[model samples]
Target chain A: MKNLIKNFFAVEEVSAHCDGPCGVYDPADARIKAEAVLSMTKKILAMAAPDPSDAAAVVAYNNTMSRYIAIKEDQAHGTKTDILVLWTDFFKPQHLEATPDLHDKIWKATKLCSACKTTVSLESAEALMAAVEDIHNIFWAAKGRDVAYYTAS
Target chain B: MQKYPENAGFFEYVLLLLGRRKRIRVTGASMLPGLKDGDELFVDPYAYVATHPEEGDIVLAWHPREADLKIIKRVSMVLDNGCWLVGDNPAESTDSSQYGIFAFKRIVGKVTSRS
Candidate 1:
């Protein structure tokens, strides 16, 4: 019978849904970028001021310090983007029920990203890393997956 | 009477589809210009068994997050672990840009032809 054949095949219906590909969230990207921010901040803070009397030394130091600042800012911005994507695209309303402070947490994390970019503060860099780690844990918890967070740095 | 031609791809689809025929009713605008909503399509489940999915190939795959939901998208890039897919109708489709990457194993089959 057609019914029997149809039941045997049982071709279920599929759909093309929206709201981004599912379960693509990973906090590791933010962590890696934040680590770079932290490393660059450290290097910048440790660099000795070039001799004020020697123009060449000053220029070289300025060149190196500028490069570090550029990298630090770039990485911080990248970290912010990654975190914001997770906040906006990954987290849902139900997650708020579990972590009511989710909004505040993401807001502060993004703020820290900006702070890291504006200043070469080791304190801010470390804070960003901590914040990112916290987000990592929260993200994994929401997915009910125990993904261990690690830093390449 | 002799028939000149029909949809050219249907012949290929028939040959490759074999016993893995699956009928899918498209309902999204993701694949616009070429495929429209309510179009009937047949899938070749064995299309990628021996070979891998290549760029420009349209495929039906499991939604990475929602396992029960199967989605159709075109492969844009082939990565080490998976493929990057996007909807043909970029304005309407939420794809790799929305998610990130889809594991290769999630692919169900190639969208062979219109039925």
Candidate 2:
């Protein structure tokens, strides 16, 4: 029994499992990408010129689309990582206790981020922001004392 | 719990964990029915080095510009300039048609299992 107790106490705590509370993350990082996706969707819809028989338009359009895709991909992943960090590192048991639906909201947000590819529409991007806002609200509420200082500065 | 030697630094520990590719559960319905939204997938980081994927093979590729993100899609066409990729869903996916061909280096690993 003594050995068991000793072994349990000796266990090393795991670090780096979650992104800690540092005001380093920006919601704009995701917003910028979402905006780009929306713009690209509009471009695709508004393209009036016929598909160029010559290789030039094909090349240009392809290149632009490639860049857009890359940006969207980056944003989607960034949001995922950010949300994960918030859930694992930032949110505490008290926050969950206060906001009973926090878990569901986070899960739905993560799922929406992944499911964005389902449509080329901007709805996914909008949904992501909405979810992030909910989290931000809870996060700010959790730090009620700090909020005043943060805003004043 | 026995503690191993503490020589490994933070980055070293991270590399060790990331060094061995992990099989993660696929949680999106984009691939759908075939590779169900929540199916398990084995991602071998080194698989791309051994064999470049062919059409119809599902793959996980690094999202360009962000090293942490992974995007999974199927190869629709392999052109000399680049590979054309598209999601299984026609109306829903914004794949090669929307984004054009993904460069070869972006590819990470091909999905080995759905179970």
Candidate 3:
């Protein structure tokens, strides 16, 4: 009965796959944005605390700090999005076979980006950069290239 | 060699009554809830041959840049040239948002039913 039904139905198989085309993926995008996150983190950490009684200094300090924090959060988010796009779209199962820890690395990198957004931690920001550089090496290695990792800062 | 590819035998019977239907295996988490991974779907290749696909239709289309890659996404907007396709699960989907809109000609079939 199964053979008869299979022959009668004649179902040709198709696949409902997801992939982002254009063949233009680069880890540099994530690197640059993540670098901004690190830069902003450093600026925020290095900024001198204003005297509470000096109203003008307090106001100016607050404004500058807020701006730095905003930029850090925004850039961290952009970096996260870029990393995720590369993780899901650019890297495939074949790449996973080569780099078995790819998923763990991406997971930690994105987590660090989130940490950068939530806190003003220099360590987290630096870790994010290191993670992105690791991914950069993996990405270029997949393409059979030896691209050097550089920072805008 | 077989007359038809992908398990379609030489002695075909269903094609005459059903137009053209192919079994599509869902391969990603994009169409979750409605369609899960490994779900088999029947796609009608001739559904949009005569008329353009309307918005809200689930379609099996070729990846705009990669001719051989097939993607299943819902028609979000019907544009002048093509359609903006989005997956049901936004977090997991890399659709029109990432690669831009897909042209009408790239669409291969419309999903009819799940098996």
Please give, as one word, the docking class of candidate 1.
Answer: incorrect
> Which tens-of-lDDT digit does each residue in A1-153 have in candidate 1?
433333344354556556545445688889999999999999998999977999999999999999999999999999999999898767766799989999999999999999999987899999999999999999999989899988897
Tell me how each candidate scores on DockQ against the true complex: 0.18, 0.02, 0.21
How far is A29's C-alpha from truth in model 2 (Å)?
5.0
Q: Write the per-residue lDDT of candidate 1 for residues B18-68, one digit (tens) a residue.
A: 566666778766676577677666677888888889888888988877758
List candidate 1 stretches off by more than 4 Å: A1-9, A17-23, B1-115
* Ranking of models by DockQ: 3, 1, 2
lDDT of 2: 0.57
With candidate 2 superimposed using the best TM-score fit, by how many Å does residue B5's alpha carbon deviate from the native? 30
Model 1, residue B106: C-alpha shift (Å): 24
Task: For residue A11, give model 2's deviation from the true position in Å.
Answer: 30
Cα lDDT listed for each candidate: 0.80, 0.57, 0.80
Indicate the residue-level lDDT of A108 in model 1: 97
Enumerate residue pairs that collide in model 1: none
- Preferred candidate (DockQ higher): 2 or 3: 3
Q: Give DockQ: model 2.
A: 0.02
How do these models rank on TM-score, best leading?
1, 3, 2
